[model samples]
Target: MTDRAFRNLDNLRASASTARVLNLLRVSHEHGRTDGWRAAPLFENSTLNRCLVIKHRLRRNEIDAFRVRRYVATKIILPIDGSDLRVGGRYIFVDQVGFDAMLEQALGIGPSHPDRKILALIDELPSLDPFLLREQLRRNGHAPDPCYFNVSEADLMRMSDFVASEITPLVDLSIGPDADLAAENPVARLTAKIMSNSAGEDMSALGQTLMLRPEEYEEGVFCWKGFLYYKWALQTITGDIGWVVDSVRRVKPRGRVDTEQHVAIDRAKEQVRRRILITCEATADMLRVYDDAFRGLTREGRPTAFRDFLRDAPILFARLGERLGAIQHIVSFWKYRMTGDRSAPGAEELLDLLADFETSLSGRERPDVLALAA
Candidate 1:
């Protein structure tokens, strides 16, 4: 062979271990063989060794590279199916027989059992140990001898020929059947539908809502979605008060009415509290709502609005505490009422609930006041 022909042959030979070579051979014989020969010209033992070295280096330096590389090596086995063949524990087995069969079929050599011979070829590789392969290649003629040299050229030619004839036809026949089966599979259909839907043009309402420049609405939606997802994932887990507070903090008042919304929320809370005092029923539940509404208002830093309203309604806070017998919520109202020259009849009851509410709301009690109360 001329230098060019030898180079071309070398390129083709490198790919002998690749599925691409088998796939090419399976396609159009004339075109594929010519392309393989073209590829052969680019091959060199030095280049191949360098590739192997780089692969080894990447395997050592990168996480999961060794595992993935090993997996890729396993995929090189067989009818070009590109499936992983892992045997449990000590060692991984490569389907050398299947590889040889593909080569034989590619070269138009013999029939089925030739694949078994390919497996034998893997066994006969220069050295199973990668280190040994590197060292041997370095010692003798620089580069591991081509695998084809381990077996006769005539045998390889026969194997390649068999692959070209029989295996290619079989693969062609199976592709149609496999495609049909894949199309019929419910999971496959669902996957395709999902993929198609994902690719389809669709405008997001959330995106539109965000574009409206309402930061509070955007934040509320995010908080709602996050809470919904959390609740969905863990039903037993209660809502996150911190997240709710954070969401409320993001609410930017759009107009005076938005400020009034805070007032409305507080008014609703006071109304609920008033109804509880008047009716003397479900005070705890009403107080819980009132506390939540206060928290939400405080999250928006509008507690002063409620405080001003409370200043006007001193009798409400005083009477509520006296009727409820110094409950924490009632005492909290009394504590606020007494905070600035506004003493009520339940001022003494303020000590415990004031400390408790301060602890609950601010996550810390006023140490001096709490100590004095104790």
Candidate 2:
């Protein structure tokens, strides 16, 4: 293989999006040998191998789009079908208005409603260790790790159906069984078909995996899907709160409340916080870089690249909102505590939630540290 081939393979393996999408394909397809799919030359004085690589990149981008939808569903504590998410060029709309209305109905229906329980579990997700939850689900032989919290198997199946149905349109256009790759040039058509067929096979396999075999390789896939979500969350949290940390570091607390023990505890928390945030930020940045490459692969007439960007755009927005929300909550809480400022809505409620969340998991856990770094 040439140096270019080696570079392409190196880049492929290093990509989080590629790894997850490829693994999902691997799990779904019982047939077909993809032994050195990454290492093989993408182009060798010919168009054949280049087409293969292009198809692989396309598959990975499509999966990354779904990852964004999953994160939005999990983050908002609502059941979202694919129809709920729409992607246009550089724009995404999640039906928050409908989602909120549904949530209100669920709330009015009381805690006994099934949606109420699901929403509650999702709300509690930020407070719990995903590793622990995943392990628990694996031990219990559940379908999806995210459904480990008291959700019924039937409900899990329903969620799967909803997701499958919602994503059908994108899949049909992108990689469904009916998809074809053709061009006016004969050689181009042949090579494109080869890659397109492979991609279609993978998509069919994924449909089976999502609906029928979610438990197969559940742990790895579960962690991989959350890659973007955790990355954005941790980075934004650390970045937004850097000022607070700097203040603590620069000004030594004096007097009754600033004892030696208090100072040590505060420093320990900062150290742990820094370690977590730094690891998350690095990996998140790497994914973003790969995503940029994925976005550059489209032709002039087809705006699929921009659509892919739209799919993941909501994730970035959501992360920024989370960070700003935290900062706003903190500021308002302090203001209220010191001088009775009631202008910031939900500040007191958010502070309570944060306190509860912080108490549930320690930032210094080795598994969490390793997971974030991974």
Candidate 3:
């Protein structure tokens, strides 16, 4: 974490760009994590404001060369598969005709169908909240894929261990005895194989054993993985929220703190602390839906409930992931700033940070607040 981390936080305009890029990055990475992305340009003022301004920086197939362009304010639902996250959408390529031709040739994007925008903000953040990632899928459209989403190698590194610790019990609870699986349905053997890779790799055989249709199996497996990631993420973020609550006030800002500014700061601190906890609790409460459904499947032997839970996961996951990501961006950003060796942001920047965090929750909105003398 360096001053560059919070460089955008000082100016109001840049701060908005910062927030937008961060949110887009989280949503993109969460839904489509396999590809490498670099945020070359954060904002632009081209005529094509509505579409994603995509350009290759250097070599054609170099995974790192994504640049920015300006376009009309097009709705980038994000690519479910790293190129297009949602259902079929439209893009109006309103930019340089010559370069547009080159991009069209390069990425197969025509003037009417130019590609790329989700990667513009990937570098500004470290990790994303699971809840927000899924929310983007729901809101944007169905992120159609074999696994419903993709996973990068970096993220999958620890997944094998997570599966090792949890999947055996899960299999026992959901499926019956091993003898039954071995004798009648050998495809159920994929249960053991699942622990080897958590990316839902080649699960069609497992899906067949579960009696899930092709589409159902794909969506179900993705939903299942999403929940797994959510569970993993929830544990870590719970600790993060705890840290934020405990240290929001304790983490010193760089500049002076006069009495009036102190009072405002206190108010802002209380609001952020209280809301952060409340938001985390709400996300936890939503997790109970999946919990109850799992209980029904394992304890009561009602696979229907679990199936229903999987089917309905996108909607619920979207809402839950979104709220979690918002708070997370705040807390994580704050933590990044505090842990840096350089001087902290001054009082005004601190005030803005608290104000942003205070309003970053579901169904909540607040105008920016001006800082008093410090």
Candidate 4:
């Protein structure tokens, strides 16, 4: 469907009560002064921050109806970049309910759960890109309603397009010239409903097209979609990533640092750069496994290799999302925090940012890359 029709369908989905804490930019400056909570524009970087950042004053320990918004560089679905930097969801970080009626109208915030684990799952990763979120839900085995996703057709098309261009040539050859199954299909409709709910009965259209069983359709096809996204993500950042690497080495902090601080910052910058290259190279290598598997399906008409690859791919997402999220975080946050007329932060802040980036890229051993993507 067209954007207009997709929006019409999006409008019909369920909504939650008036959201109070979400509209961080629009809240009255005076309304929360009595309490320690403060609401202000997330950034003075132009007028639009695309996200709402609320900070609080006393009792900082997590408690009482608050949320944590995971910062992201690019939202996979909406493809936000350049200026738009919408942060993620919330938690018990708040102590007051300033105005509950006025905050729910934002473009993305929606229904929430009470479980802290669930909330962490929502905010932990840098981006809640639906394709990965879908995988997260299935593996964790938490079943929420489809309205939980709150996705529009245009948003769903991002995954559809990625799969078409990168994953499923069978989708094109089996159908018509159109490889894109994203256009107003029942599968897309249900997937849009709950990105995690890709196991819809409507899998027939795609499954039959591929001549696969329901089991294969559920596991193999969905994993294919996720891998294709990771491939696109690696390429998109390949050109821009160097700027972040160089900036880390060259960008000077506004304040001087003691030897410990200076040495730590230097260590962090080098480590971040080195690991970023290693992780990215490792990621490209893993993607080649998918590429080879897909080749068997599309070229050799052999589904076994593809199906086997899907079973093994989930181990990779935790690594992919963490590493890519950090990379995307540094690049996008650097653009938001460092570029333009925004003044540079002190050396301490730089160290903190680099440390965080380094931590995210840690833990995964280099994959046994066949390097077919090379």
TM per prediction: 0.13, 0.28, 0.58, 0.59
Per-model CA lDDT versus the true structure = 0.28, 0.31, 0.48, 0.50
Give the CA lDDT, 0 to 100, for residue 286 in model 1: 29
Residue clash pairs of candidate 4: 19-103, 19-104, 66-91, 66-92, 66-93, 66-94, 67-90, 67-91, 68-90, 68-91
Please list the Cα RMSD from the true structure of every candidate, rounded to 1 decimal place: 33.9, 21.5, 12.7, 12.7
Write the number of the candidate with greater lDDT, choosing between 1 and 2.
Answer: 2
lDDT (10s digit) by residue, model 4, range 248-293? 8897778777888878888888998898888777777777778887
Q: Return the lDDT, model 4, position 164.
A: 43
Model 3, 1-374: lDDT tens digits are 01222223223112222113223333234433443222221222112222222211112232122244221111222222323323332222223334456445534555454123332222212223333433453354423222223343334555546644545555565454464654644334443344223425555544654577777876676677667666656675677778778888675667788888888888888878777777777666666677777676667767677777777776665556556556656666667767659577777667767765665563522211101100
| Runs with alpha carbons beyond 4 Å of true place in candidate 4 | 1-114, 123-126, 146-163, 171-212, 368-374
Query: After superposition, which runs of candidate 1 have C-alpha atoms over 4 Å from their true positions?
Result: 1-99, 106-130, 136-374
Per-residue lDDT value at 144 in model 1: 26
Candidate closest to the true structure, highest TM-score = 4
Query: TM-score of model 4 relative to the true fold?
Result: 0.59
As for candidate 2, its clashing pairs are 42-49, 42-50
Query: Highest lDDT, which number?
Result: 4
Model 4 C-alpha lDDT versus the unseen true structure: 0.50
